[model samples]
Target: MLTFQPAKPNQLDAIMTIENQGFTPDEAATKPSMAERIDRISDTFIVASQDQQVLGYVVGPASDERYLSDNLYDHLTANNPADRYQTVLSLAVAKDARDQHIGSQLLAELAKVARAQNRTTITLTCLKKLVPFYERNGYVNEGVSDSAHAGETWYNMVKTL
Candidate 1:
């Protein structure tokens, strides 16, 4: 069985393992940055584990705007929990766990939590090719994103709760 739970700071290495595998060096967050996020806003960070080993995870934070800004990724700060939208920073599934539905399950749970907290939307940015994946899971593509992270073009996607 898979167990999903709130991420803890001590599990930084585990989360990074997946992050490194899923993203490029420029796109992947540094250890300190990722740790700070897990430390500062763990309520929005979750992990997927089986037999006590983390296999995937999702990290998000509340934002005042509907779309994610470049600054948010550079500096994750304290936020207004009452914000209308939840900005998902990243979702990673280990290489070995790619074919499984763990990523979808994490997104689903995050949506449920966001709705319960009165968040109107859950937003994310992904490469153009991955837009359909998010769409299949209920997110709407809002056209090209302003982000040029890792020199890769991305698109804005959102799921209205």
Candidate 2:
């Protein structure tokens, strides 16, 4: 059984491992960067664990844009309650755990939190190949994203809360 919980500082290594394996070298957040975010706003960062072993995570900040700007990833600042939207900075699952719908579960939990905070929408940027995956989770494709992060084509997806 997989369980979801707020990420702890001690779990940085686990989270970093999953991140590195899940994304290409340029797209993965650095260990120190992940550590900073985990320590900064743990309430917005969560992990999927089974038997206390971290397997995946969903994390980001709440912002007032229909789609987050490049600066959001530069530093995950404090979540502002007045923000109209919640942006998912990263969502990934372990390769070995791919078929279990863990990503969807984490997304559901994140949506719940965003709604509770009165955020009007949830948004994210994903590769074109993953558009259908986010679509299945109720996110609407708002079309191409301007982010050239990792030098990959990206698409913007949004879900109204």
Candidate 3:
């Protein structure tokens, strides 16, 4: 059976292992980056495992500068309590674990955390190729972006909770 748990300190290494394997070098979060995000958003971070073997994880900052309601970063760090909404910084599954709904489960768990925190939305930026996938899973495509990985086009998506 698959079980979900809050990511632990030691598990950051394993999470990085899967991330490095799934994304391009620059796209993957380095250990220190993951550690920093963990420090900021541990309550919103989670890992999925079966038989104690890591399969996937979803994590992000507890709050970010970008706001979907206006699609702009706050110029001076204004607090939009909604800004505390967790941004899904990373979502990755093991190579052998694709097509198994692990990503969806991770998303559901993340949503739960958001709701518990009184966050009103869940947001993410995805590559063009991933737009449809996120749409099929209930996220809305908001706009295009110049921040694509490896020069690919990116789409901003969000789901209101």
Give the TM-scores of the predictions, in the order they appear. Answer: 0.97, 0.97, 0.84
Worst 10 residues of 2 by lDDT: 68-77
- RMSD to true structure for each model, in Å: 0.9, 0.9, 4.1
State residue 139's C-alpha deviation in candidate 2, in Å.
0.6
What would the per-residue lDDT of candidate 1 be over residues 5-117, giving only the tens digit for each residue?
Answer: 88988789989989999999999989998998888878788899999889999998899898988888888876576699988999999999988999999998888778877
Per the 3 Å backbone cut-off, how many clashing residue pairs does candidate 2 have?
0
- What C-alpha lDDT values do all the predictions have? 0.89, 0.89, 0.74
Q: Compared to the true structure, candidate 1 yields what TM-score? A: 0.97
lDDT of 2 by residue, 1-161 (tens): 88888899989988988898889999999898898889876888989999999989999988878886777778777788899888888899988888899999999999988888899899999998999999999999999999988888899999998
Alpha carbon lDDT of residue 139, candidate 2? 95
**Per-residue error (Å), model 1, residue 134:** 0.3
